[model samples]
Target: MKYLAAYLLLTAGGKANPTDADIKSLLSSVGVEAEDERVSALVASLKEKNIDEVIAEGKEKLASVPTGGAAAAGGAAAGGAAGAEEAKEEAKEEEKEESDEDMGFGLFD
Candidate 1:
């Protein structure tokens, strides 16, 4: 399921569609121990659907999922805040290090 989700996102983000063999490999890689019939049926269903329409529908569905929407926004916000803090800390550390170096505090003392 995770692989499927990732594949969908990747495809939606302009990556190429998975080939039949690629789909089979993905299923096997994900340890889906279903019969070949089940896998074939899934593939058939996917094939019957319009790729662009399916991707649009998935985006809409994801937008409606409270957890999914919230998690995405939360992750972005958290990442932005963390990145800003890290940059600030790095700048401060560099300034402190530069000041210490300017004082000639070294092994030669």
Candidate 2:
């Protein structure tokens, strides 16, 4: 993930084709030692690919993923007023439990 982030940062900064050494230097500047195998692999894979096109393709693929929430909402809508009331009750119960937990303090507190 760090390698990919560094690559994207370099590309965004006008480095059309960042080399493994460039990635290493960027990582090292922030106290991270770049692994040769990972850097080389990333560079080799992206060397021949257009970064913009690759990102566009990734976005296209991500668009097809199911978010899961929509279907549940659709089903609830189909169930009429009963489902709406149940949903409201569930939400209120959840809020009450959350507020009561740790005397209104979050987990870290």
Given candidate 2, what's the lDDT at residue 92? 96
lDDT of 2 by residue, 26-108 (tens): 99999999999999999999997889999999999999998888998888778989988998999999988778466666877
> How high a TM-score does candidate 2 get?
0.65
Q: After superposition, how far is residue 33 of candidate 1 from its true place, in Å?
A: 8.0
Give candidate 1's TM-score.
0.33
* Model 2 collision count: 0
Q: Assess each prediction's global lDDT (C-alpha) against the native.
A: 0.66, 0.92
- Per-residue alpha-carbon lDDT of model 1 for 18-87, expressed as tens digits? 5445556665676854455655555566764667798799899988768677787887788997877888
- Give me the candidate number with maximum TM-score: 2
TM-score of each: 0.33, 0.65
Q: Candidate 2 has which clashing residue pairs, if any?
A: none
Candidate 2, residue 11: the lDDT equals: 96
| Model 1: colliding residue pairs | none
lDDT of 1 at 79: 93
RMSD of 1: 9.8
